[model samples]
Target: MGREAVIVGVGDLPLNGGRIVGGGSILQVQARAAKAALDDARIPMSDVDGLLVAGLWGVPGPGLLPSVTLGEYLGIHPRFADSTNIGGAAFEAHVAHAAMAIEMGYCDVALIVYGSNQKSERSRTLGGRPPILTMQFENVWGIPQPVGGYALAARRHMHEFGTTEEQLAEIAVATRGWAALNPAATMRDPITIDDVMNSTPISDPLKLLDCCLVTDGAGAIVMTTADNARAHGSTITHIRGYGEAHTHWSIGAMPDLARLTAAEMASRRAFEMAGITHDAIDLVECYDSFTITVLMTLEALGFCKPGEGGAFVSGQRTAPGGEFPMNTNGGGLSYCHPGMYGIFLLIEAVRQLRGEAGARQVQNVETALVHGTGGTLSSGATVILANN
Candidate 1:
């Protein structure tokens, strides 16, 4: 029999309000999320044979061996451990890694976890200079933080593809509409294109509303062999296929300003591996670090032509009752975006596949595409999940 992996459980920690004062540390948040996942799966902590943790770059602690430290803290010595830090896409990559590990007889069960107190501890300065070698050259140019980098991409996309700021606002408005259905979302108030345009401008082509919220949050997911998932009597979301790709690290080093080639490569590979076409996907859960990110991702993922993202998202195509239901959990733009938003993407995908999305649920979702973008559109990971 061929080996296969299935997600047996998923859990999300409570999101702290934006810039809130008091909240648990990263370790505490991760532990709680892990416990929740274990409980949800009806599995004991000792049953987890693999552990994968997302590393926070600037945060203090066991910098070199974050996964080992987290394992020790959680009191579960796993046979397999990984700490692959590719920015926000780390979690999605971890899912791929965990599935491969399980298929290779390295582990029977795996737990992928992430947690961050960026809003409470760091005041949401996640994209600050990291004292890296690239910063020496890039910082001198006075790049306008992360927002500025995204604005540059937005500008280039607009110039080449005729993408407008109003089109970008459509993404935020549609995502916010989903937020209104989610009580846990940070920004539930519905927004319009005019409201997004009138909001405070953080960058030339990007407004405050276009940016994702800064909040402290954590999430975890449990993946096990398909047979084990059946034994647990849990809602099984099968890992049909996955693929990852990366381009440049720094925004200045990006080869193309208007396009995210990594997303294109990743999504194409995932769809091919899953043996499905773009039209077969019932829903999408993509990282929305900014409105531009979502738009560019849609184009790169083959939802539309290279320069047709603006028109593809027009007329509230991604909103509730729209043809393409996306970001049904409000996305990072309206929900909580800690340092890493990839884990939340998996959580929401699982919810939608399990038919647990409540008011925002898409009817009869059999397949979902979860994509994550990290860095300044530098890295991308795509996972195709199905409920069988």
Candidate 2:
């Protein structure tokens, strides 16, 4: 048998919308989250010999931040650590890397963590310009912020295969249904197809509600070898398969907006690793920074054929108690979007596998597929998780 890495524990801070947290800085939040995860696994902090931290985008200085800062704060230093920033895919990649480290005998226990202050930061303003290093030429020509970029992709899908505005609205409506069950969700009011249709328009085809929530949050995941998982009495959710790929960072350079190449490649590799097909997956946590994101990912992952996402999501297909359960934690659309949207996908996936989600839980979620996209649909990372 090949070397294996398992997620032993997971924890997340409450997603608060009204007020932002200022006392706890990024490092403090991350430390707290990491500690919580370790506690959940019933392991002491001193047992961690490896640490992986998600990179921060808004930091103005040297850019990259390693696990050292949080390590020093938490008083648990590890010899092996990685601080990676591939856009929003950082956390998912960290989890995968932790698995590889344990498999290679480089470490016994690892902590994967992320934290952000998107709400308190002024740079998050809609009119605020991204840093020079973060800016893309595509946005210079009034391409309409992130909303416009995704809207353009959605419009192309409509023109090519009769995809309709109503179809896109279906994603928003269904996600809101999930949000109603999550008290942490920012938008809890039930919405209808008409509500999404008549809502204020941000871009040509995208409405205001079509976008994800803006909030501040932190999350952490604990990884260890299979043997360590069992020895430590941790709730084990094995990483059966995972894949990552990227095309271009800019939307203008994309050959086809409707089809996501990186997502397809990553999903294919992940499915092969897990030795399972789409039918075996009881839950799916597809990143949804925007409504179109979920639609594009659904098609890319073979959940539906190209151009069939809009129709596939209709009739509450992805809603609670639906045929194909998805985004049960309300997702980025209604749950929270703290710039690191991909990290939330990882959080929700682990929560489902642990059967910790009470009201929004799905039945028999023994296996799950999580896909993350970063930048302007530039990078993709897919992880297949199984419990049993």
Candidate 3:
């Protein structure tokens, strides 16, 4: 009964002006999203026997007991519960954890969810961290929080490779192109590389358009045995392969400024487990905390040789009608990025595999690559999904 783990349902809320349309606390919206995912699978909430959740909603008590609090709020006691937080990559890692739990006969149906009210609550800030161990080294420099870290990577990549600012802009412009087709995306207006170049510079070569959207968003995914999903006649995406790794919490500790070693290692392991080649991949959905994030990830994931991402992403290759389709849901760059963006990446991959993405749907999609990066290029998780 537990031969394979497949995702049968996913739910992501709408966004207006890059923020959730309705205001609600993190748990409230997360609960609704959970209900929506369960309903989509034609499974009642009572059927959920496992839960995997991650969030920044609770600080002290609930934060420490994230899964416990979510369980209490949902009014369900699960036989299997996990609250593994690896930053934005946490949700992708959760998928792997749930797959093992389901296959091990610990839980039949598992739910993974994420919700954030940062935008609505105006709680988005890099200023709250207490200056301690790692902070002791970084906090004093006054380097711009996450953006500065990513900018360092971008600058190093440029120095190592012949990558150009125009090449980096191509990612932003292409992502926006897909966002234009996505009604749920916050920034839908068409943008050009020139527009990106002209936008206010945030950190060195990174511009205002290079950063991700700050929005309040919630999403959920439901996974279960393949037999269970087939019995319910639910279209499903196979959780064929997954792997996660992290190298550094702070930028100073990153192994190489020119490359994301964690992404390379994680994707290599996932690809080995799936036995899939680069040509077999139909779509790529990776984290886009910044335009550089996407560019660097593509290179790290072996889609192209290292130091070749800028060239790989140029010419709108990742946009619609291009040879490579990526961030079809606009990604965190244009889509709603509620702190942790990995959950939405999973949902979009499922939707695309199910052929549910109306306009942005790719033809003959059988395999999709979903990757997430958390912290300041601190962690990476890769999941390979198949609709076979």
Highest lDDT, which number? 3
* Higher-lDDT candidate of 1 and 3: 3
Kindly report which residue pairs in candidate 2 clash with one another: none
Instruction: Summarize candidate 1's per-residue lDDT along 1-388 as a digit string, tens digits.
Output: 5778889889987654553234677677788889988888887889998999976733564846778888988999899998988889988899999999999989999999988777777646645676579877777777767778889999999999899999999999999999999877889988899999999988888999999988878889999988887888877888888999999887888889899998998898899899999888999999999999999999999999999999999999999999999999999999888878999999999999989989999998999999999988989999999997
Q: By lDDT, is 1 or 2 better?
A: 1
lDDT of 2 by residue, 213-269 (tens): 777778888888778788888888979899888887667766698888889988999
Q: Model 3 segments beyond 4 Å from truth?
A: none
Cα lDDT, all candidates = 0.88, 0.81, 0.91
Q: Relative to the unseen true structure, what is the C-alpha lDDT of residue 310 in candidate 2, on a scale of 0 to 100?
A: 80
Stretches of candidate 2 off by over 4 Å are 18-23, 123-136
Top TM-score hit: 3
**TM-score of each candidate?**
0.97, 0.94, 0.98
lDDT per residue for candidate 3 within 193-301, as digits (tens), equals: 9999999988898999999988889999999998899898877889878999999998999999889988998999999999989899999999999999998899899
Worst 10 residues of 2 by lDDT: 57-66
- With candidate 1 superimposed using the best TM-score fit, by how many Å does residue 324's alpha carbon deviate from the native? 0.7
- Model 1 TM: 0.97
For residue 53, give model 3's deviation from the true position in Å.
0.9
Candidate 1 Cα errors over 4 Å, as ranges: 16-22
What lDDT does model 1 reach? 0.88
